[model samples]
Target: MVLLTLMAAVTIGIVRARNLFAVVVLSGIYSFLMASVMIVLDAVDVAMTEASVGAGMSMVLMLGVLYLTKVEEAVPSHTPWLPLFVAVGTAAVLLYGTVGLPPFGAAENIVHAHVAPRYLEQSIAETTVPNVVTSVLASYRGFDTLGETVVIFTAGFAVLLLLRGRRRSRPSDDA
Candidate 1:
């Protein structure tokens, strides 16, 4: 409930902030809070990815864009009812789905009995890491990590290319 409230506030701030920097910072905060919620949900891998991509890389990219362009711009408001309707409808569906979920940490669920146990049992032997999550990410699912690294590198390269210089000011013709 608290997480949902924080998410809503951060989203509102991101939408309403006049300064680009403030919007970016608010988005980063939103990402961080989302990551925390993911942690609470026992989705550490997703949380890690979200933290790195959202709070870390995206914030840097936003800052770079802000440096290249002025931080403030005149914002025009438009009819927001369409988005409001969509958001409310989506939230309703999500709430409905949440009611069907197994209670947290229920041992009888298929997740604990089947999927998670295999990792807990085999990962130590397979990867020699006491932490199953680390072992899975670094060893078992290495290819996916490599792909994510490549994507991050590509994003950084693209940002660099896009922001590569023309002088911010033009010299006077008299000079």
Candidate 2:
């Protein structure tokens, strides 16, 4: 409940903040809170990724964008009703789905009985890594991590391209 409240407040702050820096900071706060929620939900890997990418990398990129652009701008008018309706509808659907979820760590869950157990048991032998999650991320599913790295690289490259200044070449005197 507290995390939900924090997320709501951060969303409002991000929308209402006039200063770009304040908005960026609020966004970082939102990401951090979301990471905490993921941790509480027993998704440590997701939490780590969110903390690093959403909070750290995103804040750095936002700051770079702000540095490349003007600090102040005229406020644009936007109607919030459509977005509010969509958000509420999505939340309602998610809540409805949550009602059908098996209790966390229930033995009858296929997740625990089938997939997770194999990963837990075989990962050490397969990868010679003590941490099963790390082994899975780095060895068992390396291609996915490579793809993610490429995506982040692409994002950084795009940001650099956006911020790069174009120089005009002078016509040669001989020409």
Candidate 3:
């Protein structure tokens, strides 16, 4: 409960901050808080990934980008009513979608009955990996991991391209 409140406060701070540097820092804090929540929920693997990727590497990348960009955010010329409405609507739809799902931590859930047992039993024979978690991530779900990597790579590449374009369009310092 304490972590959740801190996370909410950090999210509000991120949303309210006009300073880009502060936003970046707050985002990292939010990520760390989320990782802590994951740990409390007993998802240690997810927590580690969130801490390293979300709080660690992502913070470094955003900070480096900040050096090339404005420190403060510019005020928007128009209201964000459409975006706000869209976000609320999306949240409603997602919540509605989840209404039919089993309660959290229910051992009789579909994944527990079908998928998890298979992974525990067959992972070694199928993937030849000693560690079940490693086998599931590296072999059983290899394509999903690759897809996530590609998405991250694509986003980073897009940011680099945008930065390059902005640099090229600016007047040279030598002039």
lDDT: which candidate is best?
3
Residues 15-127, candidate 2, lDDT per residue (tens digit)? 78888888889999999999999998878989999999999988987786687676665676887899989999999999999998888766788677766788789987888
Per residue, candidate 3 scores C-alpha lDDT tens digits across 6-84 of: 9989988998899999999999999999999999998788899999999999898888778766798998999989999
Candidate 2: pairs in clash:
none
Backbone collision tally, model 2: 0
lDDT of 1 by residue, 1-175 (tens): 6997999988988888888888888999999999999998888888999999889988987787687669996856888799989999999999999998898777787667766788899997888999888887888889998998999899878765754544344322110
Candidate 2 similarity to native, TM-score? 0.73
- Give me the overall lDDT of model 1: 0.83
> Against the true structure, what is each candidate's TM-score?
0.71, 0.73, 0.76
Off by over 4 Å in 2: 42-46, 72-74, 104-107, 165-175
Q: Model 2 RMSD to the real structure?
A: 6.0
Error of 3 at 61 (Å): 0.9
* Model 3 TM-score, all chains together: 0.76
Question: Candidate 3 local accuracy as lDDT?
Answer: 0.87
RMSD of each: 5.1, 6.0, 4.1
Candidate ranking under TM-score, highest first, comes to: 3, 2, 1
- Candidate 1, which ten residues in sequence have the lowest lDDT sum? 166-175
